[model samples]
Target: MPSALVFFTELSDAPSKAQRELLTLAASIGEPTVAVASEVPEAAVTQLGAYGVNKLLVAPANESSFLDHSLSALEAAVKESAAQVVVVANDNFSREVAARIAVRVDGSIVTDAIDISADLVVTKDELAGSYSAQAQASGGVLFVTLKPNSIEDTPQAQAVSVSVEELAVSAATAPSVRIMATEEKVASDRPKLTEARVVVAGGRGVNGDFSAVEALADALGGAVGASRAATDAGWISHDAQIGQTGVTVSPQLFISAGISGAIQQKAGMQTSKCIIAINKDVDAPVFEIADFGIVGDLDKVLPQAAEEIRRRQA
Candidate 1:
């Protein structure tokens, strides 16, 4: 049977939501083989096994300093294992590595895959997520990047011994960029934006005040997001924006506060499992799609809700 190879970055403990989606995709393709870069912890390996990985391939830690070196190792492993499909988590590093690997192996590359079927037809968003496109790979090895939160997690029972392999480092042109000191952000107790099970978003209706939104998010144990209008109005940080031009999220629960829900805003979060809207205007577009609706000023409602949650927890 043909095999599928799933690539893992060093952050294996809390694998990106995209990585988990790729694992689910690999299971449907064939016996799943997980390929991890060096320095991955044993706990992560155990998690992959629990996720139905049939084989684990670990690259040497020394080979990961350069992108080309990592690709070289992965290419050798793919060829040696005869994997017909390779699924990579869609991120900056993975995209760069996948591009090089695709060129080297002469495989077809598909990015931002939302879904995959038995025939390997991959669905992806196009035109800034205004439309969807479907395509299939014809020959050689196929490479794909999975979108975060697009696939469901379904773990199965499959166990195989982990393997180690070394590939000949290929001669490549020098990269134009050099690494500099990197400062990592301090971790937060709130759920990660992309991986959060629930997300609370604020908008222009909040009148440039995000205190209530932040409080509600903290009470709910979710990340805080904002609409483009709110960000453009300087009510919230750009990183908090969520719309056609902003971050896309598909969480199990999404709560919107004082958001009018433009089409652009809806496009990014329409896929959320459940939606709740808190806006003073009952006719707001946001209320149309909300599973639950509260028509009131968010400033008044948020504090009470937060206090209730805190009281319950206490």
Candidate 2:
């Protein structure tokens, strides 16, 4: 039977969506083996068991403390376990790790996969979201990076004992990059856009102001997002921008305020479960696909809506 290998990053909490999807896909194929570079808490281990992971592989720490060493260790683990399919999250670090693993294993990599079917077929969008493509892994090990919220959240009942093992790392051929001081930003109360269930976004329609959008998001218990126009105008942080050139978000609910709904922006959020648009122009492209459309000034409409939502919650 073919085995699936799932690689997880070291974080404070379990990756909810990635974990769920990997477990589901693993169960679909065969037994699932989870691999971690750092220590995972017991609670997280139990959660992984509930999701159907049969084994957990841990990598040893290195003197360099670089992810390249971690990637090498994971590649070795994959080869030792003879896993035919490897699933990783589509993040900056994971992207690099996936590339390194592919080169080490002489495998083919598929990035930003939205779905997986039997026969190891993966779907992804391309050409600035103008088209979709599907490919199958025919030879060698398959490396896949999944897009957030692309897979359904289905937890299974199969639980297994978690076993941890350290992977052996090889000596580097060249000197590794030196790291200096690292500063970690304090986390905010708002949900992370990539993990949020609901995202409220603003654009140039707000006239270079994001206060209303932020207030609305707070009222709805969601994250604040922005269009390229708003980010270019300095109305919001670039990290909050959603478009082809920015972060891709597929939330349960997406609300766009004063956004014209350009194709670039839609490419980032077209897969949302529900879309609501509040634009002064009824003919704005955003309203075409909006489940709920409000033709008015967001400045006036958002305040009322936010107060109403807060009142109901209170």
| lDDT computed for candidate 1 | 0.78
Write one digit per residue (lDDT tens) for candidate 2, span 170-226: 646663654455678888899889768889999999998788899999998899999
Enumerate clash totals for all models, in the order shown: 0, 0
All models, RMSD in angstroms: 3.0, 2.2
Q: Which residues of candidate 1, in runs, are more than 4 Å off?
A: 13-18, 61-66, 125-133, 158-160, 166-168, 171-173, 233-235, 307-314
Q: Which digits, one per residue and each the tens of the lDDT, describe model 1 over residues 57-115?
A: 76655432456556765787677668888888777688788878888888888997778
TM match of model 1 to true structure? 0.84
Minimal lDDT window, size 10, model 2: 171-180
lDDT of each: 0.78, 0.81
Q: Ten consecutive residues with minimal summed lDDT in candidate 1? A: 163-172
Estimated TM-score for each candidate? 0.84, 0.91
Stretches of candidate 2 off by over 4 Å are: 128-130, 173-175
